[model samples]
Target: MATRTASCSCGQLRIEVNGEPLGVGVCHCLSCQQRTGSVFAALAAFRTPYTVTGEAREYLRTGDQGGRFLFRFCPVCGTNLFHTEEDVGDRSVAVAVGGFADPSFPPPEASVYDCRRHGWVVLPADVTVYDKDPE
Candidate 1:
């Protein structure tokens, strides 16, 4: 199993996953843009059994589709680290790709909310694009 560790900028919060992500994607939704302070938010979803070290602050936000997402960030540096669907069992977790700080990390497999993506940004032709969240 290939393990990957992701941490906050201040190194106060860290997550360790024992295997490759179940999926890797990028979100161009307005909320994701605001949350990441970037054009898009890149994330890698992994199954349960991961480990978290250090405390974090959480913010709950409702998506455009009415799904509630609980975002966790480093309390010390305010770096958004991971998030999960509220009320759902611990099946998976989505961690911010930037936290890995690894250039070799896998590329995003999908791009969601493409309608909100910046006109200047271009993704690889291999990436599957969705105007909105895929069903």
Candidate 2:
């Protein structure tokens, strides 16, 4: 199994994951854009039981799909680290792709919130797209 490591900008927070990610994808919802301060937010989901180090500040917000979204960031440098889904129970955890120390992490297989994506942002021709949520 491959172990991935990540850290905040100030190096105050660090995370190490054992094995590969559960999934990876980009979210184009308005909330995601606002939270990430970008056109879309990239995320890598993983199963529990991984080693996570350092203390991170968190913010919780509700999503358009009525799911509760949590954002965890470094309190010092304000580096976004990971997030958790309230609606999907507690078995899954999502880490920001940018936080990964690996340069060749898994690419996103699908995209969400296509309805809110920027017109100039063209998606891959073969990837699955969701207008709103995956459901």
Which candidate has the highest TM-score of all? 1
- For this target, which candidate reaches the highest lDDT against the unseen true structure? 1
Candidate 2 lDDT trough over 10 residues, lowest sum? 45-54
lDDT of each: 0.95, 0.83
Model 1 ranges with Cα > 4 A deviation = none
At residue 75, candidate 2 shows an lDDT of: 90
How would you encode candidate 2's per-residue C-alpha lDDT over 36-106 as one tens digit per residue? 78999888888776666888898999877678878889998888888888888878788889887667877
User: Positional deviation of 89 in candidate 2, in angstroms?
Assistant: 3.1
Which pairs of residues clash in candidate 1, taking residues 3 or more apart in a chain or in different chains?
none
After superposition, the stretches of candidate 2 with alpha carbons farther than 4 Å from their true spots are: none
Candidate 1, residues 2-89, lDDT tens digits: the string is 8899999999999998788999999999999999999999999999988999999999999888888999999999999999987676
